[model samples]
Target: MKKIKNVRTVALDGLNAIENNQAYSNLLLNSLIEKNKLPQKDIPLLTEIIYGTLQRKLTLDYYLSFFLKGKKKIDDWVQNLLRLSLYQMVYLDRIPDRAVLFEAVEIAKARGHRGIASMVNGTLRNIQRNGLPEIEEIKDPIERISVKTSTPKWLVKRLSNQYGIEVAEQIFLEQLKPAKQTARVNVNKATVENVLELLQKDGLEVTKGEIVPESIQVIKGNIAHSHVFKQGLYTIQDESSMLVAKALDINEGEMVLDSCAAPGGKSTHIAEMLSNTGKVISLDLHEHKVKLIEGQASRLGLTNVETKVMDARKVGEHFQAETFDKILVDAPCTGFGVIRRKPEIKYSKTDKDVHSLATIQKEILQAVAPLLKRGGLLVYSTCTVDQEENSNVIYDFLQQTCDFIKDDTLASRMPEKVAAHVDNGELQILPQYFQSDGFYISALRKKV
Candidate 1:
């Protein structure tokens, strides 16, 4: 079973899966890589192309419009093929123009008509000759950001409403760039220094984490494929995500439950903070997802984590009242904070999705509230930055829930760089704030 070198061909399968089959981008890319068993070099290339195409589709299409100005008609495959090829030519400096077109022509011929292949070749060549059209003439920042960066108009508009033009534009621009590949060193397995030494020895560059002391940011390394990750030496995570566990300020022996734990990033972080002592029940809605928690716990050699495939909204039957010292509702939301990493969300997400997700967040929060013992802590967080999902949710909860108050611990815990944005007992991190995702976290304490 020889691996494939036709990166564009592999990427087209993924693009078509997203465009025609409604598959998620990440899942489809992973599936394509597995099926082809692409060599390590092509993995990043194909991923970058596929995601880059999806990320800047609007801008690519806008540029293509100028190329098609001669009333020269094109078909669906031609359009998609041109979009794919031109993404590399205009945006990616590493791939030479002729190479990108050659691969695209091969893909076009394999999957499309000869005429369409010619169309792709002409459009991409025209792009190289004419250069991309100037976008500064566009007056509206939303449209400008959307056109220049390849984000959707609807998303730019929504973000403008949420964060205003100046900040929202930065977020949109950030989405166009690559994200930091960060990982938290599992203190139980290796110290940050040890992980740094190991990664450096492995011919990789890494940095000490900007936030947590045990956290190490990988500046350049495939930690996932390295022995460091396999040995549970570290777990890939965003620096902003690591803040959730730190904000909790857990001691060595407190019981903590990561409700809705999936692909368990925070669940393991919490366990490490507890020094692998006491209990951490990682609960999710599916057995498959719970396995993610179990996997992380195993990798980190954390014996204290107990994974359960139970819904966070309906876990009362198994646990005693006031059983846990702390409960974390990393409630699922619209994922607005992470749109940069998952750019497809910009096009596919809707206002209705946010409302639906907010409803679930409220339900999960209320259900998990009783699980915490008196004086116990509850940290409600969402990757979204909307008021509806953040402060507003907390506000409505506190108006009636007399036993809990917004914990001021966050004010004291705020990093010097993050303090200016902390407001009214809630930390709303706009992505541009820390080169991180837009996150909302509020600490709540039971009256005791």
Candidate 2:
């Protein structure tokens, strides 16, 4: 029989894979857990160590630097062992510091040479005894928030420039935390009360979402694993994301287009809103993603959605001009807003990436603009906090397209709690304020 690997050892392997870009944290860890048949109880700690280590990487490295004092260059594995252990030391109050240090030394010895083991022991011990350096020593304001919040320096500066120092810091801090699990009820299959009763019957702690009536916030348990989930009673979607399709406000028998639709969250939601009546065209760039949309529609028993593997930038080439009653350009983005769920984004994305994604977002928006009929609603949305990809893209689009104007009707369609966040026909939901993923949504109408 194959022995189950130690949780720390498995976590270290997961961290190494993430460092080498072999896989993302979530996928790698889940793969490791399943492949090794890891114990159910140990899963949480393993998850905490890996995510906590990556989530607090920059901050941990900054603290480790004070101890090393630029004295030695250790092997990457040794450095990572110390990183994971120190993550527990600094962030996890439940794990004793001495236990963390001992685990690091042991893991180091098991994974590396004796010398490396000694180095890990010495460095972590020094930190436990002496504590981290004062963050105030970082002179630059942007650098200060970057290190303190463990976000990239470029993002800190950009957010500061866009929202000013105070709000930028808030955004940075919010990215370091984990996002809650929220799901949208498929009203076609089950009402909110019906789904809530079913979820509660399964012993899952859930509450109705404050902004969107169709959404529910799951406080505990793996909600997607519930029997009700398999019944197509609901879908796992962020509450903020559930608002995008609502902003479109499609009517029965009116055709709708979802440019850049993938995984079919919004497309299926739109189909649900239509009560499976009118047609909904879900377009994705890749064939595999198109299948995802198809699968979602099939599972929801929605016959109105038609999946197509086509680039959103060339959407006008396939359909006639002004052919659809509503258009949703949920453009690809830098995804700075979703760092809470994917902490690696804090390091993976750069300013150049943000600028590049903004261009693509603009191209997709301009390409799909002609497809909307006169007076048809066009809602542009992104799961990002970057201004270049959000408000700036919309501003630039408005400059180029005189036939389109901002539609403030987005507020009237949403609950009052959600409507309060709308401004000038655009809603930018910051993660900190909403306790959900950061997102931006803007509604526009084609001039008759």
Report lDDT per candidate: 0.82, 0.87
Minimal lDDT window, size 10, model 2: 69-78
**Candidate with maximal lDDT:** 2
Instruction: Give the per-residue lDDT digits (tens) of candidate 2, residues 188-288.
Output: 88889998899999999999987788889888877868989888888899888998998998788889999889999999999999998989999998999
Per-candidate TM-score against the hidden true structure:
0.94, 0.97
Off by over 4 Å in 1: 1-5, 69-76
Candidate 1 global Cα RMSD? 2.1
lDDT of 1 by residue, 1-448 (tens): 4646577878877887788777888678778988887887788888888888988888888888887887556666667778888888877898788888788888878777787778778777877787888898888777888798676777678768866877778877776777778888888777789989989999999888775566677777578789778898889998888888877768889989899889899999999888889888899998988888898889889999989889888977788889889889999887878876777777787878877888888888888888899998899888987777888788888886889998877767666677566776689887777777788889999988
Worst 10 residues of 1 by lDDT: 71-80
TM-score of candidate 2 to 2 decimals: 0.97
